[model samples]
Target: MQETLRRMQKKRAAGEGGFTLVELLVVVVIIGVLVAIAVPMYLNYRKGAANKSAESDVRAAVSAVEQFYTENGNKYPDDVVTPGAVGVKVTFKLGAATDGQQVATLSPGNTLVYKQLTTGTYRICGMNEDGKVVYKYESAVGGSVKKTSDANLGDCIGAAAPA
Candidate 1:
């Protein structure tokens, strides 16, 4: 009986059909490495997307200002759009708001600065995740638009006009 039991035990040990602890650990490590690599990539992609979105918003605002200028005798918008100001005519259409609210605010928690240098000379600038002005559109008084930054916007400057 003892000899039979030993033979059965040997058969069971030989037929053990599962992964060893080392093999499982290796697989887990590989998966962990992959996750570590993939997560940052995805996060960067998302950040890039946000930056582009903010840039697009600035583009739209530029277009609106240009259109308004063309329709109103080539004058830049005279609205105070940065919130908490008064006594200015908000005479531009910047994406769902025509009441002096900055178009940059449409980007949802993005830091965008807007300035009207002179009559028909204006700039709309937006910051990236690193708080750098990576996107900017400068509208000169002569109906010309130019891109003035290349910090973090990818492929967004392909259509930039000569400064």
Candidate 2:
């Protein structure tokens, strides 16, 4: 029996060995665990990036609106429509009839039915949502492009000064 065992050991050492099923299973399980952890983390990171992008888009829109306001002597164009070239867009309707809101007419006014484009001109407003100013941006030209502040879109706008 001892001789037989010695011969078996020699065979095993001479490249006659193979991995056991249990060992192979362990390696597979370890890889699966790593994948499970890594996939969700990557997904979460992507979502955060999207939200940041949207916030940025809003800021850019705000700056554009301010620029329009300043340059045209408080005359915000009533319909700053989105150009065809624009991919992403954010549309912002001028605020309601309060808080010094300009009424739209033949000339420039505080209230505008305008659409914000992600590519070209855009607008963002700090809407009075239940006291806190919620930043929302609407794309003037709408299509496959995403402009809303969410996990899907990171910071869409430029690092513009808020209005």
Of the candidates shown, which would achieve the greatest lDDT relative to the real structure? 1
Instruction: List candidate 2 stretches off by more than 4 Å.
Output: 1-13, 79-134, 137-163
Expressed as tens digits, the lDDT of each residue in 13-47 for candidate 2 is: 99889988999999999999999999999987855
Q: How would you encode candidate 1's per-residue C-alpha lDDT over 75-161 as one tens digit per residue?
A: 556633332122222232342345333232345444444556766476765543454445677665344333455653322233332
So what's the TM-score on candidate 1?
Answer: 0.59
CA lDDT scores, all candidates in order = 0.54, 0.44
lDDT for residue 122 in candidate 1, whole number 0-100: 68
Q: For candidate 2, give the lDDT.
A: 0.44
**Model 1 lDDT at residue 119:** 61
Worst 10 residues of 2 by lDDT: 104-113
